[model samples]
Target: MINTIVIDTEDMDVKPSAVILSIGGFAFDVTNTSETQTAILQVARDPELALYSAQAFYGLVDTFEQLMMGRSVSSETQQWWRAQGEEAHEALVGERQNLATQLLHLSGWISQHREARIFFRGTDFDGSILEHAYRMCGVECPWRYNGKRDVRTYIDAMTRGIRGYVKDHQPCFAMTKHCALHDAMNDAEQMTLAHQINSEMLAA
Candidate 1:
């Protein structure tokens, strides 16, 4: 009965600290991992947004419209993602959702699924981008303070047991597609797995 929201976010740039370029998220139960709901919101781009390097654009943004419309570009992060591999680029842009609409939609979704706790892989980075996005949209965030859960910390504590179980039992997480949607869904799935494994270990 535990509903968990797994989320991932991509940044627009590095130096000034980038704004959120895109977001992928999904909700699933820790006990019933098979049933999941997902959301992807790619921010609309600024018309004057300049590329750090022409090649950097190759991976991150799918179109001019999908780019973060109000925020400026990040040269350092652009060069960094350029070096990261093919799939990494897809994270910046996917299905387009205006930042304002995306914020409203997420707020509504969270409200509907009030029992679901938000879980992000990178607490600091993801939290910052999302909070900034809300501020940019002039919207109050949906969740109460401390509503976000730390997947990294929970997973870190279960690392040794999870590693042994995976090695011996061959449990696998969904692929890290580098797409925001897929990554977020993966986090949801992994959260369920983590809860399952930890409970089993403790019971044993």
Candidate 2:
């Protein structure tokens, strides 16, 4: 709801690694709780990614061969995904295409929402991967770093500011729906809801 561009990235490597597997996001207008079209990237799948299954698939290893272009894998992270449930597992696999082509599509989306504040759960991972992709294609990053925001801080603060409480209930998408595109969509929807809650709190 806050004129946000919610984003998420699936990476081959863990921290300090830009080997992103996919990027997905969408724009949201907090004013009307309106959402824009979603943007998703499909990179070239790598066979080597299959080796990390002993630890865990995380979305990258399980979906690597099915996904698009990406960097090397992170064994530690792979184990984490392997430990997740089927719902989370299902979220990793998605449509596939070349990294360049997918980025081109993502680039256009970013451009359209250039003025909006870009939000990512882990800006270090998601934001860095996005910049790396644009750099790889020799395209300028559509949004300035200053305009980019972190979802964790904003959501936590807003929740407390409004004295909001999270209910003990099932999630809209099970843990299996933790894929890159779906996660991005989820973040956007949460922000939209947060904006609405904030508005109501202020009005009262």
Candidate 3:
């Protein structure tokens, strides 16, 4: 069971900050804050599970990037990008299976070890970029074009009944007017902003 669901976005955009993926007793928190700044958080009975999640998540991003770029990924290419992608997919599975596996493990761990629920919060770009990348990579999300499982529900929950905020917040940062929307921020900085916004929300 998912105990916590935290969505992060800029005050000006509706992009998702993070998507929390939990497994038997672990959580792999995936975030797309920047081109190179991706994150995976693992929480399980065994600490080693975190390593597996990290490797798998990184492999997924790498494979997805290659597919999105449309580089000649065939084995005939001197770079063998296609073969490398195939190898990356194998590595991702060898490291971790589908999203469900990670969630189930986290649920089990919470039940047996009394671990706290996992939550993710970040900028709106997180969701938008992720959805775009997923689509580009041919991965199907059980959500709408905006990447929210339910658009109306997502708006109400994220905006807290602030109609104007809900109305203006876009699914991707690129669509927003904020100058920082597309400005590259390192992973640590992005994480800091995410935490800052989450804290502000809690304080309110």
Candidate 4:
């Protein structure tokens, strides 16, 4: 009896009362006025935090490369790389330290809301990304299959579930589209898809 119905961000409707959930560059704008009254949940990563982690990892790799190449480390490059590494280290450590607190907050948020649906991009690795972010934020997601490797299967299951829900509930018209994972979609394209899905969902 899963009451939540999660939709991809690109499929969101732009209704006035829609709950918007934005994570990374993706967003879910859900119309909450349906008879079911599902809450739209958006899970977004903090760009600054992700950037810090990436910079740190990249710096360490580049430093090791420079060392292997026998190139003298310029003072400027050394300083810049060291700073990036430190920033990343700090960000990661902070996230780990706060993991518990973040999870509690997420659990609370989900429990408080009636119909809670999570939206993100990429059916392959997005779940892992969300899990890592949640860990950093001190939250433990009760939802199973919230990892990157499980996404493909999870999506397949979701599609089947949606299909069944539509058939049983007799929605006007239900539509599902598969997009490239992790690729960026232009604003126009995203908006168009969102509108199209809304129209179809309403028709169902």
Candidate 5:
């Protein structure tokens, strides 16, 4: 049984060191050697409520080529890639390096604080996507693996796994689904609600 660790996030003068991340990508297919395409990655830093994010998209040219060969991708996705044209891949040259550097830097900073945590909605999905990206870049994930936290797990535990409970009470910071940046920001907001719920339950 997992226990929920709640804190008084609202009244605290000094915020804890943490970050929330979200990734928008193709369906997670472990069997696929290509490891699915990661469309975007977003990060929301806590304490200062700062957003230190880097956005990157890869394989647009390859996707476009595939579509030319009559790939059966969704019309929306195919149109989006077609709109980017063949030069889409070259336009974002070195973006992967930039993304990896930013991730490495954030991981390094978080690792400096023993209690710092990295929060994501799903550890298996989001965390694995991040790990795969880092591996592709030949960069080691600097933060301790134990520091990785699951927002969904914490929130579910706080709400006793009641569906829609968190959604009803949580702040409406997320406006768009399937968007990494928006989802990451929303997760940070949801964490505050989780803390409040846990605190109230404890008080009662």
Candidate 6:
């Protein structure tokens, strides 16, 4: 329907704002680097687009409880945790500090780009996780309430409520399914293409 109708008004400005982010979930695994992609340096180099993945660290008690809760995890992973002993606790503490540093860096970026819009594929999931991470780190989320944007909602608006169409059409690339960086990049690319198409429609 978006393709069929051309609304005559001010041209829709689809040039994506400054940055796109995909925060990883609450779960933390020291062995899994896929969930943590700290892009502070990248953000410094390119102000046009920024992507980051935030990870949370839980205490050993919580970790074991989580292990017990996650029955589907492989035996090897369980054994790995068991073998960690005091080293695992130390690692988690280090990770928590790293998370705090990352969040502070993010806050600085957001402060610098005061008007930038933060886009997320699933805001409720990613956004909440990021916010919680901030709280856990004792840092305030820097972006404003209205600055939080959702990719699905944007796509639906741009495509006349077309559902699941964009998911299948990821631009020429292989996404490492659960990898935070890959997922964020994929979503950002989809939003960019959708914005381009929507802009063309408005011009037409």
Query: How accurate locally, in lDDT, is each candidate?
Result: 0.55, 0.55, 0.30, 0.29, 0.38, 0.40
Instruction: Give the clashing pairs for model 5.
Output: none
Tens digits of per-residue lDDT for model 5, 1-204: 111111111100111111112222111121121211121122222211123322211111122332343323344544554455343323333222244455565454344443435565656545654554456557887545665667778677775665523766543432343344344444545555665677678889
Tens digits of per-residue lDDT for model 3, 1-204? 222222222211133222221111122222222321222222212334343442221211223333335422333433432334443323234343333343333233334323223222232344454444355445553235532332223334544553312333323222111111121112222333344444568888
Predicted candidate 6 versus true structure: per-residue lDDT over 18-68, tens digit per residue: 011222212122122222223322322342242232322121112232223
**Distance from true position, residue 36, model 5, in Å?**
33
Better of 4 and 5 by lDDT: 5
| Candidate 3 structure, TM-score to reference | 0.28
TM-score of 4: 0.29
lDDT for 134 (candidate 5): 57
CA displacement after TM-score superposition, residue 10 of candidate 4 (Å)? 19
Per-residue alpha-carbon lDDT of candidate 1 for residues 147-166, written as tens digits (9 for 90 to 100):
77777766656545433122
Better of 3 and 4 by TM-score: 4
Q: Which candidate is the best by TM-score?
A: 1
Pairs that collide, model 1: 44-67, 44-69, 45-67, 45-69, 46-69, 59-89
Considering TM-score, where higher is better, how would the candidates rank from best to worst? 1, 2, 6, 5, 4, 3
Would you give me the overall lDDT of model 3? 0.30
TM-score of each: 0.69, 0.68, 0.28, 0.29, 0.49, 0.51
Measured over all alpha carbons after superposition, the RMSD of each candidate to the real structure, in angstroms, is 9.1, 8.9, 13.5, 15.6, 14.4, 14.6
Off by over 4 Å in 2: 33-70, 92-95, 161-175
Quote the positional error of residue 2 for candidate 4 in Å. Answer: 15
How many steric overlaps are in each model, in order? 6, 12, 21, 17, 0, 0
Which is the better candidate, 3 or 6, if ranked by TM-score? Answer: 6
* Candidate 3, residue 107: how far the Cα is off, in Å: 16
Higher-TM-score candidate of 5 and 6: 6
Q: Which stretches of candidate 1 lie over 4 Å from their true place?
A: 14-17, 34-72, 88-95, 158-176
